[model samples]
Target: MSSTILPVSELTPSAAASEAEDSGGKHPFLVALGQRVRDIRARRGMSRKALALATDVSERHLANLEYGVGNASVLVLLQVAVALKCSLAELLGDPTTQSPEWLMIREMLENRDEATLRRAREAIGELLGSGSAKASARSRRGSRVALIGLRGAGKTTLGSMLAEDLGFPFVELSREIEKFAGCTISEIQGLYGQNAYRRYERRAIEEAIQIYPEAIIATPGGLVSDPASFNLLLGHCTTVWLRALPEDHMARVAAQGDMRPMAGNKEAMDDLKTILAGRAAFYSKAEFQLDTSRQPLQPTFLALREMVRNALQMDQTEHAE
Candidate 1:
């Protein structure tokens, strides 16, 4: 059971040219598909050879896939997706973009700038009754402030302080998750695995949202790993990214006596950086972010307090010195 990709048989230049000609002007769909495959592979931290082994698909076919010349059969595509641990839809994109009007609209929006795309997303959300128009956005956002970021970013401490100041209940979601599973996080993951742990995590969040309207919630660092749960938090709470420097993160985690990451693992810093980079885009989706490393805890708390109060439209003069 070796997880090794067999050697790939190279295609001749004439054969490549024939593939090009047969694809009818480079096959726009498959070209985008190949690019998508490459991007997903990178994000998943899998080398092309690794992916080939995981899928049990030939390296030559995967090479064709990356080259945008592979007319992959349904079975082959399914195997690759299963190996990649993502749905075929996610890897290939929504299959519903088939109609002429749908294709044209999609094409038009595909090249628009981020700002334009964001505005379009907002509009679509509103029209679909899932956006800000459906609720008093400020009230909803102000009531629930969810802290997100790396584990050592002071989410627990800050969440408690902010909650007490706002007279809202403070919920450390990780604790609730453990309660739901009837074991510690390490035990949950070790015994049942990550998938089971994520299920517990999702349920914990759902229950938190349903039961507590006015609360300051400190979420697990990896909550963003599950898009459904992350989207739920985004829709229901005012999310904040509690940022810290890489050195600060390590120091803080070590100070807390959690040496799991750094214990005998010399590449811990590099791994931490990679995790940060991979999840940075998702963290940036937070409505607000504060860098805790720039100032002392008290000042950082004060700044966070100010930001949250303003976001929730609470009394600013109460804590004024």
Candidate 2:
């Protein structure tokens, strides 16, 4: 099987053809579905050829599906999801209403407005003992502060300073993942594949949440790609999205001298922007957002510190006060 390649002229999804299928002038749903397919595949570090062979899907079919012009049947999608180790509903960008309880819950909440749905979620969380009044109290103390963003968003440097000011431990979840897997991230993916690496990631995050009562934690950018881990982070932590312009993100990562996988790729910047855009929707789920590209390190850190302190209901002084 050859690599799945979309011709240069057809780099983006085929809007006209998709619309014709609408038999719809455009198929944003299928476009998004295709994007999810590509995103999950990339996260797993599996080449198109690998996925094609693994699923016994023809390379041409996979490429067309990815380019958003091919309307694959349910069976084809099932095979792709199985090979990618993700749920079929996830691949199709639909909420999983498989279980009876889930279907019942969906029925109860269906067609509700956003505000109503939010209240319903809060009610459910409280009932489950997960997001009750105690959770609010925990948030006031800043029990868990998780910073999420792409690689060059200053999670490491800013997380360290925030932890120091708050007098709490700082945990880098990526390093913890490596510890749990007993290998580097690349090696974990290479040796056991993305699914195993995701297991390690889930374990590492769960451990961090369990062992640390109050701390600042920096997370992997791709953590958002794994639904389970992202949900755990969201349910347990006060998440902040540190955003930067595409150029700034690239430059910052380069300045750190750790371009490991992206060093020589001519299209690295374009690829970076596409990944950032794809994950931006997920990243925006954070409780707060800070634009790190707006200022220098000190100023940006100061702003972040203030924003976090405000969220924690802390006074303007350091924890020592």
Candidate 3:
């Protein structure tokens, strides 16, 4: 007996062509589908061979599928979804699209007036409760505080100070990421690509949380760009956003004797400002916010120290009750 291979023409030719056209030649549905499969598999720490074996598909075919050129059958896709432990809809849907729950919420609010929608949103928030309540409960039992900010925002300096004050370990997430990649962050990005770097970043955060459940962690500035990893960070650690003015950020970076920010670009300040603006919304999701611009180092440190101490004490009191 011989096995039969399906051709691309047999796999819904019209639909594929329509998708390719809709994407304006940037990425067809199949390519996006393959990328989604690869990302999910990476997050689960599964190899292509493992997925192939689980799906009962040949390694070569699985490779083609991941590469976004395979003309996979519906049955094959279903098997792949099952093997990846995800729904078929997830495998086939847009990778960048919002989750189904958010989409349904949007649809439900589409026809409502602004006032009604606002009330509904408030009710939903009240019913679901704040993420901070859950975080406070966890903080009483675990001492994980994650500091988030841009490069020159003093995350490393302040994180070390806080860790020492609290008698907790301090971990720089970038260093962990480098350790996982077996090279520097720049080298990892150059070698494997940005997506691969993010995968390593996510894995590094997971490992860090597992290893140092009671520690202060300094995270990369752009970690929030990846929603899934950022959500994991928020869920596991009590996050603090250390903020500063754009000028202070630039001055601090320069004070460190690292001129890389202005090494090749005359518009480095403009770029930095743009990056800050883009990430401000995500940074605001942190449990606490502290501004570190233009203040004396001693004063800022003391304030942060006192704030953290109070927060921890409050959590402990709540737990006692």
Candidate 4:
């Protein structure tokens, strides 16, 4: 059985709105939803017929959905989202749209001074049981430490050392993401797009948290770009920013036999500098900051060991209290 294809003209926002109006005051939300579905399906390069087959919906019904004339059930929407390999939220609204929790927070902060609002937000988060706040508190009582920095900042090396010294598991988050995606990070980005990569990154973090309650995590450099996943990291792990000069970062990568940093690129160092500058604000949010630039590896290792030891001691004290 062949499915009906929606005409380009019928898929337009104006046409969708008219169709909604003609349907006896059916809400315009269906039009928006249909558009969203069509856009995502197109982006994923899935044909409507393929999607319909995967989602167990008729192609004719799917055409009506794309034309913003069908009233799709929640179950149908969910199945479509599953077929498209996205969250229901992603299908229903923009990914960056502020959630209800954020809206409530904005309203609560109205007319408040910065300092007062900060304190009030903390208190309210604790009172209303904010997941990030609660996770942060739990992190202080647990044994998870995440190292954040640019590539070649010694996160993997130092994290492995610290984990071995402390008798805890060491996890590289990017590797976990690749494992979950059943491919390399590069492959994931190439095959699924950056948004999908971010989704996998979040899922990898969540799984790591569950699998290794007491572990050292070495995170990807761009992990901070995703606010939700970064917040989850900040809330659940004692983060340390491993700092280094751009020149040193370049030198280290070259030393590791990965000339990709400078290969065929005269402006690689400049690009590194720009990236570091852009991410400095986010990296500075870590509870601990350690500079590993222009120092011997052994001395840097010693300093990192001391920092981790102190942090663990502090965590123990907080738990005891």
Candidate 5:
């Protein structure tokens, strides 16, 4: 087709004024062109699929063009115009001749009413001024993380691997807990019950934060069962849940000869499932999650490392802004 030209004389002063007002008193012909193409396709009652087949482009590609979310190559645009049975200028209602969405968006932005701008500013301030503002600020300063998961999820094994790879110190929270409690973990749990064991767990974490401050901490799996304690941990560090199916967890723990959960509980297997189900929601709340089930130890550790790296990068970017 010959190059399509939009006639300036065909446009009304009011329509021209509207376009100018919308486009910051300037021409946004490309954006206008995109909207016009979409309008033409819609007017013909042709679906994106029909246009795609006729133009030999994918339907998704055509939709992206219509939405103006992606740039259409020169050849693609020409093919589309031909399929629509219209010249390029006709398809793109020329601002010298048509109205466009970006022109409208720009107009809204630049010519925004006084009240609207005020509200927008207020919202921005509130979002950046809250307690999370400090957390976000710290997020930029560094990309240190601590991995917290259940016993059989390979805390010590994975912690050493992660620390070596990331060049950070690897500290086991359980070991710290044992020292703080001044008793073996089993002794604490047996004498004081789960509650007292958790107290010792909290104390160990507090001391670790104060001392190490920037190490990869491997916390006990049962941490989330205590919300108050876990929230405290979350505030001090970025938390990731290393997750696996209950059966996988059970197998790993059993392989270690620590069958406390399975010992004479008749409903031992059922109890395990119940505990896993109960903690499912809490685990799901983690900032990042990794499924370790059926994955080799090395690959699972690698996946966890990448996720931490990505999360740290995201935190840095957010904090910098």
Candidate 6:
């Protein structure tokens, strides 16, 4: 599906300026975090209202937070953090990582150094291909590759690639609902509002799972904004995070099409960062994180494949034992 881009004239002056002022801003991070929050919420099938009820925060505030607004106070932030079962530091962006193996591998991949990428791929391939390597039972038991990241993090693009390469069917949760309703997502939002859209999305996801249990599914970046649906997803599948920089997300989304998020909203970038600050805790819950910034399609795909292979093999070994 094509991305929607809003023109400069349509964007609120403040929103445009915010985008411009953010030098390597927090939009991408916020997008990822928001997605994670939404996914967790959706998999739980909890509505925004439900989250509000649990956190004692207003629905509008929740919406604003999800949209990447800057109104979230420390108190409100703590409430959300507690409700989501996470620590404050994690939600506030923990920068003191000791550099995990995956991060190093991802860095190597992002370097665009052919030798390093090839070696990484070969090493992964050999590890998986070894005779003593475990068989892939996770694939048989039905693993889910739910895409989590800010909008325009190539979740859809990478999802399609994953489904095709893995020989599984691909389903975009948002697109499925749009197709089912016979209307664009924006239209649905305008007509029924976020709650109603979630209702439709919930149905679409349930139906999709029943129809194709083992498939690659590309959920809307914001699906996790609603708790009920997010929980449902978590119960049904394994999730992966498509990590990227905020600027990258804005650029990609802008290039693809819809600028509505940035339009007429002067605080768009700041709002994005704020949202990410709240949601990072949730997204960090995912099983794997795939950093796609500056990483090409081929190596990223290979890395994902390797991750899936490892997961499957682990599952198989568990079953065998």
| lDDT, each prediction | 0.78, 0.79, 0.77, 0.80, 0.68, 0.66
Q: Candidate 3 lDDT, tens digit per residue, 145-182? A: 89898988889999999999899999999999999889
Leading candidate by lDDT: 4
- lDDT of candidate 6 over 1-321, digit per residue (tens): 111221212223355346535734536445434444554455455677777889998877776665455546789878877886544554454442122464355555764865565455435534654211113313333655677777877888888988988888888888899987889898999997988788889898788767876778888877778766765565556678888777777778878887866775657777777776777766765668888886787888888888876875666567667
- Poorly placed runs, candidate 6 (over 4 Å): 1-141, 262-266
lDDT of 3 at 275: 99
Q: What does candidate 5 score on TM?
A: 0.55
TM-score of every model? 0.65, 0.64, 0.65, 0.65, 0.55, 0.55
Q: Rank the candidates by lDDT, best first.
A: 4, 2, 1, 3, 5, 6
lDDT of 1 by residue, 21-75 (tens): 7767666566666665776676577877799879888778897886688588878
Steric overlap count per candidate:
0, 3, 0, 0, 3, 43
Q: Residues 1-321, candidate 4, lDDT per residue (tens digit)?
A: 444333322244576578778877656778767777877776677888899889999888887776567587889989999998766776676533225465355556768975685567446546655433533466432778999999989999889988998899999999989889999998999999999999999998888888887999999999998877877787778889999988888988999998889975758888899999999988986789999885888888889889988987887776667
lDDT of 5 by residue, 218-237 (tens): 88878888866665565556
Model 3 earns a TM-score of: 0.65
Model 3: residues >4 Å from true position, as ranges? 1-102, 109-141, 264-266
